[model samples]
Target: MRPPVEVCVFLLSLLAPGVLYTLNNVPALQEPLPILGIGMVVLGSLLLLLLFIVRHKTTLDPLFYVFAEFSFTCLVGLTNALEQDGFISNFMGFYLKKGEPHLSTAYAVMMSYWEGVVHFVLFLTMIRRMFTRKSYRSLGLLWAGSSIAHQLVHVPGVVIGKYGSSLRPAFWRNVPFFLVPFWAAFLLFSRPRETPIVTADKIASEQKKSLLSRPVDLLLSLLLLGAAAFSAFRGFVVLDCPLDTCFTYIYQYEPYLKDPVGFPRVMMLAYLFYALPLLAVMLCGLNTPGCSWMLDWTLFFAGAMAQAQWCHIGASLHSRTPFTYRVPADKWWPVIGLNVLLAAAPALLALRCHARPAYFMKPVPKGEANHKKKKN
Candidate 1:
C-alpha cells in the first residue's frame, strides 16, 4: 500500500514553497508577501482537501516532519541567494542587507552562499532519503546544529550593526528560522519512553560487560568530547578578543577574529552557547544506558560544529581578511584537518549511539511489582 495521506500532502507541500517563491519574485507583482500569504492559504486548503479525499486521519509522522524541514530550508535558501545577489525587490534582503554595510562585503557574500549551499544539500538529502537512517540522523544533526549557529551570526550582525535601530522587522522575519530547528530537534528525539521487562538472571548475565567490547564506540565518544572542548575553546577565544582588535590568538595560531558587517564574534558566542550545554548533556549521558536522546543531541551538535567551523574557517580564507592572517602554509593541513575532524566527530558519535543503543539501555528490574513501584 502507498504511504498515508500525510505523506502525499507532504510531497505536495514541498512544491508549493518553490512555487510561492517564484510567484513572489514576478516583476509585475512588485509586492510579493500578500501573494505569498495567499499562496500559503491555498496550500493549506489543498492539504485539507487531500485529507478529505483520502478519508484518513491527519497524522504527524516522521516523513511529514521532514517535509516541514525541507520546505523551510528551500524558502530560506531562496532568500539567502537574493540577499547575496543584492536583489532589492526581495523585501527581506532589501531591509536586512540595506541597513547593514557589511552585507555587501565579500565576507557576507561568502557566508550567505555557504549557508545557502549547506541548506540546499540538506534539502536534497531529506527529500531523496539519500542516506541510511544512521547517515540521515547524522545529516539531520548537522543541519539543526548549523542552522542554530547561522542564526546566531545573523541576529548579532543585524542588531549590533547598522540594523540595530530597526530591530522589529528583522527579528520577526528571522523567527521561523530559529524556531523550526528546535521543534524539529524535539520531534527527532521523541522516541516513546517504555519500560522493558527482563528476568533477574538475564539482567545479571548482560551486566558482565567489557569496557573494550566496542573499541570503535569508546573512540567515537572520546572524539565527540574532544570536539566539544575545541568548540568551547573557540567560542571563548572569539568573545575574549577586543572588539576592534581584528585578530585573536589561541595558542600559537592567529585566525581572523573580526566581526565585519556580519557578527563573527557574535556567531562564535552563539556556537559556544549552544555547543557547550549540549556537549555537557552528551558527556554525562555518554555511558548512560537507554539515553536515546543522546542520538538526537549528537545530530544537533554535528550540524552546529560543522557550520560554526565553516564560518570561522571561511572568514579567515575570504579575501576580506588579510592573506597573511589566513591559515599559514605550515599549519594548513593540520588546521583544516582539525576542523574536518571536529565536524565529523558528531556524525561518527551519532552512528555509534544508534548501533550500540543497547549498550546504553537502562537496566530493567525483575517483577511487575517493582516496575509498578518504580513507575509510581
Candidate 2:
C-alpha cells in the first residue's frame, strides 16, 4: 500500500533540495546565494504544486511532522558535511573558519563525520515510522531532545562567531531548524498518554519498596544531581564568575570553560535546565508509582544528555577551544570518564523505564475514552 499523501509530499520536499543542488552545478549561477535561491525557488514551487494536488488526500499525523523535522535535520547535517569537504565551502564554511582559534577543526571534522552517519540512521528511522506504522516513542523523544540540544549550541555559535546580525540570510535559514524540532517536541508532548501493562508481580514489587530505596538507584540519582550542579556552575564560570581559586583552576585546566562567545555557554545553560528538572523529577519520581509522564521525561533526558555530552566532549578535547581550557593530560582519564558517564546515565534511565514500563504507566482518562467512543 502507498504511504499517506502528507508522507509522500514530505519525502518529495526532501528530495527536491538535492535535485536543485545538482541542477545549480551549471555554469551560470555557481555562486552560493544564486544557487541557493534557485534551489529554494524550485523546492517552494514543488511543494506548492504537491500541496495543491494532495489537498484532498492529505491526512494529519502530528508524529509524522516530528519525524519529518528529524529527516530534515539529517539533511542539514549532510549539507554541513559537504560544506566541510569544500563542496559548498563559500556558503557553509564561514562559521567553521571564524571559529578557528576559538573552535577546534579536529572537532568539526569529527562532528561532520559523526553527523553523516547519524543522519542516515535517523532518516531510516523516519522511513520506518512512515511506512511500517510502528511506534518508537522513546526513540522519537530522543531525536527531538537531541535536535533541540544541537540547535541550542548551533544558533548561538553562529550568531556570536561570524553570522553576526540576525538580519543575515545565514542566520535566518537556521531558525527553521530550531523551530521545527521544538514544534515536533511540543506535538509529541501533547499526545495522549498511554498505560503500560501492569501485572500482579509488578504491583507486589511496587508495594515492597520505593524505587529510590535501591542502593544503585540512589547512587545514580546523586551522581546525576552532582553533574547537574557542575554544569550550572561551569555555565556561571563561562559568564564570568569571580575568579576565585576553583574558578581559576577551571579556567586554566578546563579551558573550554573560557569560551569567549556564548556558544558552549548557551549549551551549558540548556544542559543545566534539562539536568536540574531531570534530577528533581527522577528523585521524586522514583517513589511516585505509575506517573505516566515518567517515560516521556526519561526519553527526553536521555536524548538531551546524549547530545550535550557529545558536544561537550568534542568541544573540550577536539581542536576548537583555546588551548588554555584543554584538560590537563594527568587528569584525562578522570575527566573523560566522567563525561562518558554523564552521557550514559540518561540512556540507562530510558532503558530502565522501557524495561519495567508498568512502573510508569497511567490509565487513559475516562473523558478521553468517552470522547473516542462518541466519535466512533
Best by TM-score: 2
Candidate 1 per-residue lDDT over residues 19-135, each given as its tens digit: 544644654432335444543465466656554545553442444444444454454445554555556344333323322334544445555666556666565566445222223
Count of backbone clashes, every candidate in sequence: 7, 4
Candidate 1 segments exceeding 4 Å error: 1-143, 161-171, 191-214, 241-254, 288-292, 318-330, 364-376
Q: Report the Cα lDDT for residue 166, model 1.
A: 48
Candidate 2 lDDT over 153-264, as tens digits, reads 7666656643344323323456666788788788768776554445445544654666456665666677767666666676676666785944774655566655554566
Which ten-residue region of model 2 has the weakest summed lDDT? 95-104
Q: What are the clashing pairs of model 1?
A: 141-299, 142-303, 145-304, 146-303, 289-360, 290-360, 290-361
- Model 2 error, position 255 (Å): 0.6
RMSD (Å) per prediction: 6.9, 5.5
